[model samples]
Target: MKENIALFLAILYLIYRYKTYKNVNKIIEDRIENVHRSFFKRIQDVLQCSKEDAEKVGLALDKYFVPLKSKFYKIDNNTYSFVDEGGFKGSFSIDQNYNLLTLEYNGVDLLALH
Candidate 1:
């Protein structure tokens, strides 16, 4: 009976862990999707261009920007940096609402990011 109880508890713990893992993955997915959407919207608004054009620009920018969410994280919240293979470095910040507040590439201000 003691062995059965231990096995049951282990099973319960595994289920709990699986659920927690799924929740964490979902949260990450949602955050990434939100960032991409916000970036896309900003690109369209700034360029005053069609959806296709905005998408192309956004996709290209993603090469530099997505790393902010994936890697090169700073201890400071909402700030991230990216360095390309060519040694071009960039930084950007996100607001509480997931909006891009600022973007700088190689010391050049890419956008006002209001």
Candidate 2:
């Protein structure tokens, strides 16, 4: 029916808009990461801790603690959940090939695409 077709079209349009927005958001995030990397990846840095340590800490905070602290986010093409309300705590992580930044909520791996 025409009504169904119109609804489908609307859904497709919404999807298009969402994808575009996500792409822009990702670009912004990448730029921010690049800025950090540029500073830390330098060979002759004067910082107390090495760039590797900083990267590790960043990974730990993001992969392990982020889900517990943040509301929700997607990383590496997968979505994750993190919610805490007193005793009712929730968390999740997604990882494949490596667990470098994978987060877990309770006992469930919410980040797995499979």
Candidate 3:
């Protein structure tokens, strides 16, 4: 009788762990679907392209963003850098925490906000 009670408790614990894992997996999957869906949806709306054309659009963006991201840097002095792009002048800052980096543009910085 004692062995039977112990085995029942073990099975219950295993079931609880399995359910928790399944819920986490489901949340991750939902987030992925949102990202992919919105990405293709925006492309289709902007370029008037069909869903079938997304591969080419994604390919072009992949090519463009590689070099575009290189120009940004973090200065140790912790002051914003200002730029004058003729029609636009700007100042910008980067605040980092863990794996996330957020860029904030001061009015003087002609940073591209996208």
| Candidate 2 structure lDDT | 0.49
lDDT of each: 0.64, 0.49, 0.44
What is the Cα-based TM-score of model 2?
0.31
Q: After superposition, how far is residue 107 of candidate 3 from its true place, in Å?
A: 22
Please write out the lDDT profile of model 2 over residues 1-114, one tens digit for every residue. Answer: 999999999999999999999999999889757654643333113223456764553354344444222333333243333454443344333334223344455665534532
User: How does candidate 3 score on lDDT?
Assistant: 0.44
Arrange candidates by TM-score, highest first: which order?
A: 1, 3, 2
Candidate with best lDDT: 1
- For each candidate in turn, the TM-score is 0.38, 0.31, 0.34
lDDT of 1 at 102: 69
lDDT of 3 by residue, 5-64 (tens): 999999999999999999999998896466555654554454444675643443333332
Q: Can you tell me which runs of candidate 3 are displaced by over 4 Å?
A: 36-114
Query: Candidate 1's residue-wise lDDT over 61-95, tens digit each?
Result: 57545432322335257666656566677777665
Question: Number of the top candidate by TM-score?
Answer: 1
For model 2, the run of ten residues with the poorest summed lDDT: 39-48
Better of 2 and 3 by lDDT: 2
